[model samples]
Target: MAKTTTASKEGMAIRTKREIIKLLKQEGALDALQLAKLLGLTGMAVRQHLYNLQEERLVAFEEEARPMGRPAKMWRLTPEANRLFPDGHADLLVSMIESMREAFEEEGLEKMLEIRNRKQIIQYLSKAPSDLPLKEQLEALAHARTAEGYMAEVIDNVDGSYSFVEKHCPICEAAKVCSGLCSKELEMIQQVLGEDVDVERKSHMLTNSNRCVYSIKPKGSAVL
Candidate 1:
């Protein structure tokens, strides 16, 4: 039937998109021509699929300049695309948390969180320059957080403050069960940034938002 044919075509498109995502994840970035050659499809077909994926915000492209000729556009998976990949670590984290809770109870969980916070502070402090201005310190903190899979960014406010936005949380699965982990993270951020700045959670992923946002302001200053 005509309807059945249309449905089949749609299903094929979905399968093709999944294949493209998988390829990007495994091989990093590739051009449409490269992807077409690998999939045995025409360049036009691969490009069409890439277009759809881009509209969905799962894929992105960067222009890479070569020694000669026009720059080649390389396609890559965006942070949103990361959710499609299997999180093997999530299962391991949950298992570890359960074991700790069973062996040491609530106090054990608290201790684990405390140790994590202390270690995180030390790690971040080692990378964050103490002599930089407040804004630069926030930028350094954002870079460190991004390296740790938080996908964090620093946004400057007009009033001389910053907004720390984390578009992705790698430990969401663990945080669902152990929310104290999130609390410790906030405490660590405040402690590491110094005593003159205040950090407040403006938005949270646990409340169903897609990202977490922290409003950073100077102490004794008006809220941003």
Candidate 2:
């Protein structure tokens, strides 16, 4: 039937976009020509898919300067694209947290959260620049978080502060079961960024927002 054919075509489009996302995630970036070659499709076909992905804000492109000739266009997955991938074992994690809460009580949950926060801070600090300015350090933190599938970015505020925005939360499923997970994450960021900077959760996805935003400014400084 006509309806069945339309559904089939939509399914194919979904599968093709999945393939494109997989390629981009694995290879980091690729041009339309390279993607077409990988997909065994024409460059124009690949570009059409890329256009749709871009419109959805799932993919982004950049220009790479070549040694000779003009800059080549390269496509890659945006942080929002991370939502398409399977999470870092969300089901298993949520179950474990629930069990901990039921068996060991609230104090035990707090201890577990603290331990997890320490580990995350150590991991992020290992890659984040220690000698950079607060803003630069925040940028590095965003990069580290994005690499871990958080889909984070840094925005400069007009009031001489910066906003750290995470468009996607890979562990949202886990955080929903254990509220401590979210609070500890904010604590971890504060610890990693140092005492000189104050980090405030301006917006939270758990509280009905589409994304999480952290307002960062120097200690004892008012928003200008």
Candidate 3:
């Protein structure tokens, strides 16, 4: 049986890491093979992820005795990780709208007056050129998204799939419904490509103590 845990939304820079924490929080502990099989990732990939998580101080492991080999490392989510994600509420756009409403309430018509300026602020600050490689562009966009409070993380699956993990949903958390943050995320994704890129949304947090595996298969290449 696999142990599970719920990952909090704090300190979890990526959605994948958050989902992994959630799994570890709920399930308790999982071996590498179990993590690989459950999350649909290769063992080596899983190990790399585990190492990263460990470095973040989000996960710990014990050397468990095996039947015929040396003791193997079994990973577990720490309490700190559980505390980070809090509840799995993804109120993305709703939160954004609520924030806008609050600002409007305080600023009144001034809010409307400031909207274009705010837009200009972001447009001026965003220096992501369109000439970079798709991967590089994605990384730049991911950085921007993270700065804007999306908890975005970019993963190069090494298979050609670029996994963008959304860690926070201010709208979802605030409005509870009537928000299509996921759609907006997809739209941003489309802007980075000339042709139709195979952007897939796993609809899972990448942080919670559990593995949320995804691949980026290159164009005309076999999917991993």
Over 147-171, each residue of candidate 2 has an lDDT whose tens digit, in order, gives 8877788989889899999866778
Model 1 CA deviation exceeding 4 Å by range: 1-82, 85-88, 222-224
Residue range with the least summed lDDT across 10 consecutive positions in model 2: 79-88
> Could you tell me the lDDT of residue 61 within candidate 2?
92
Model 3 residue 122 CA deviation in Å: 8.5
TM-scores for every predicted model: 0.65, 0.64, 0.43
Ranking of models by TM-score: 1, 2, 3
lDDT of 1 by residue, 43-100 (tens): 9999999999999999989999979999988998876776774443877898899899
lDDT of all predictions: 0.85, 0.86, 0.57
Give model 1's TM-score versus the native structure.
0.65
Q: How many residue pairs clash (N, CA or C atoms closer than 3 angstroms) in each of the candidate models, in the order given?
A: 0, 0, 67
Q: lDDT, candidate 1, residue 29? A: 84
